[model samples]
Target: MGLLFLTIFLTDFFGYTDALLRFDRVRRKVWMFVGTRSPIELDWDRLTPVSQGITPANSNVNTFRSVLLVDLDAEGDVKFDGKYPRIASIGQTSLNEQQAISQYEYVRQFMELGPTHLPSCETYLEHRTVFRDIVRFFGFLDLARNIDWRRPGETGGGLLVLASILCMLLGWAFLPFDLATYIAYRCNRVPKWPAKIEAYAKDGGEMTTPVGAASGRMRIVLKEVPFILLWVGCAFAVYAWVASWFIK
Candidate 1:
């Protein structure tokens, strides 16, 4: 069970580094790369943005997804090189049509008007650490997003508040998986862009490092240490109690 858990986390951690699409607004081009294949370069004008949606066999609600179809061969038909298409699934998937459009608009606006006048993006986790990796694996960021600290008490008063509390209490159940993810992340490496793509990106100007937010290490120590220690202590106690039955 432990090995299987570690394998799952490792696969997920490394899967994200296998393929990437680099959109260069400055050069008005997009680079499609997968593994060791020669990267496909497409002009921004040739790429068509299409919104797609699907209803799963078991589900009733439609889940919307967006993609940019790039015409590799200006003649209108998609040509495959050996296996994969030249470019595929270029945009973020969303829950609904509005969200899909909003995601696209965010990219479009950034492409057209630079980074100014847009809602600030979440501050990137500049460097990876065990705590940050664990936070990501357990979806702490998602929980934080749902709570909305900026407008406290605005997400309803009674039931919603109770639900959030319950959600947090249940979140600790994934401690084993989160710890496995940290191990996988510690061994994983970030994917490097191809030399050609790197050169192209550096053509106009060097890419700047993203601004990072406070890591909240101090806050975690002060507010969360006791809870974590308590959880670990309880887990060990339960293990010992269970093992004692076998000993008898």
Candidate 2:
């Protein structure tokens, strides 16, 4: 148990800490280039266009007029058109129509030309790589599950099993055991937080999952309970073994 606790403390603190640092580095890199904090959103944008394209393929007719004539309402969804008009106008705009046509043509050209400069391309590629790294990191879980466990001896097996158990136990102790479920509940109930706490004041205090509940529990059990129990067990075992020598 002494060995088990030591192993878990080292692995959880060092190994997991290293993994989290790498994850954060990739996350930061993705955010720095993509201009978004979310890695998942960044990944999605790479695979899917923010706005639909007005191509000859998607359009009914080959001519611009025919495509534009199809429907203004059908125009691709603008994600950040309001926020970044310059980027948005690159795809929107037309020569013939002043307001409507110009914007459409601008958008069309922007999509067709893509990013013009090398710096833009490099920035886009860097963000893409960061997104890919996030995906690959998540993929490692699958790889871990497939790894063979039988190769390790009894001591190794015990250590691995205990570490796995401790992680789960500690995680639950630190975080809300039902955190995922609580989040799901909140999502279904409120969907969004009220702009002001007063809005929900009429209804009892806003519900929050027992935050840090898991971490607190983990600290007590992993750092205190198990540490003491394991050390005491080791000491008792050592004393028992030595006592047998005297009796014999």
For all predictions, the C-alpha RMSD in Å is 5.2, 22.7
lDDT of 2: 0.31
Q: Which regions of candidate 2 deviate over 4 angstroms? A: 1-73, 84-205, 210-217, 220-248
What's model 2's lDDT at 49? 22
Question: Which ranges of candidate 1 are over 4 A from the true structure?
Answer: 1-11, 17-19, 62-64, 72-76, 135-172, 209-219, 232-248
Clashing pairs in 1: none
Cα lDDT listed for each candidate:
0.60, 0.31
Over all chains combined, what TM-score does candidate 2 have?
0.17
User: Across residues 20-95, which tens digit of lDDT does each residue of candidate 2 receive?
Assistant: 1001112221111112232112121122222233436776643332112111123444334234321211223332
* lDDT for model 1: 0.60
Please name the candidate that would achieve the greatest lDDT relative to the true structure. Answer: 1
